[model samples]
Target: MKKIPVYLFLFLLLAGCSLSNVQHNEELEDAIYLIVSDENNDKLSLNSMTTFDWDKAYLFTPYSTQESITEQLGVDFKDPSDIDWRDDIYLLVFLDSDQVIQYAELERQGADFSIGEKQYLTPTDDIINIKHD
Candidate 1:
């Protein structure tokens, strides 16, 4: 009877550990972002881009332009048609203030590149723009 109780306790402890590991892996896979540049090869400014959410990922620069914010800190910019979904690179950006978190993935389809689904640390509405040089 004593051994039976011990075995049950061990089984429960192992199950809890496994569950934690799975959750940690999931978070790692979702924490990624990409950096986008402008025509002049300069990073876009974050002033023009919308604030980021800490819990969700964002597509920083969807298009290349000369007038848009050329530099951003938390946003991940990419060309939607140039990404390879199966072989996409993963990236993660930590906001300076610790308020916003960015994640990104690239997916390539035929002649087009697409960004994969992103997971942010927070909602989009909760992000505030931070200036950078």
Candidate 2:
């Protein structure tokens, strides 16, 4: 009846809202360029995954602490706010196929860094190697 139709409409509306709010992580294969930040706040552009040291890479979740990120990046911060993602941290920037820039905070592991929020680790050295122009 009318009550059933109203309930159905309300359910669809809520479902659509929730779906829209959910963020979808971009696939690594969709990324064209990987930009990394150095300790001096300098940026390095890696056009291909081959340039990245993958043997020492690992995957980490985004649920990390400010202290942990600071320690991993080998930077000192008296306050969490003192940590700048653009400079004081190791960030892995992914320029996706859709021209959308996605980023993840990186934690150094010896010679290589672990990417955060990435689900799987694949040998990407040979996949996409387009240099950023």
Q: Judged by lDDT, which candidate is best?
A: 2
lDDT of 1 by residue, 22-115 (tens): 1112233322112231122223222224243234333433333322211443333332233222233323333434333333332211212223
The local lDDT score (0 to 100) that residue 70 gets in candidate 1 is 18
* Ten-residue region with minimum lDDT total, candidate 1: 30-39
Which 10 consecutive positions of candidate 2 have the poorest summed lDDT? 124-133
lDDT against true structure, model 1: 0.33
lDDT per residue for candidate 2 within 99-133, as digits (tens), equals 21233444332223333344323445222111111
Give me the runs in candidate 1 sitting further than 4 Å from their true place.
1-4, 23-133
Score residue 62 of candidate 2 by CA lDDT. 37
Error of 2 at 94 (Å): 16
| lDDT of candidates 1 onward, in order | 0.33, 0.35
Give candidate 1's total backbone clashes. 37
Global CA lDDT computed for model 2? 0.35
Error of 2 at 16 (Å): 1.8
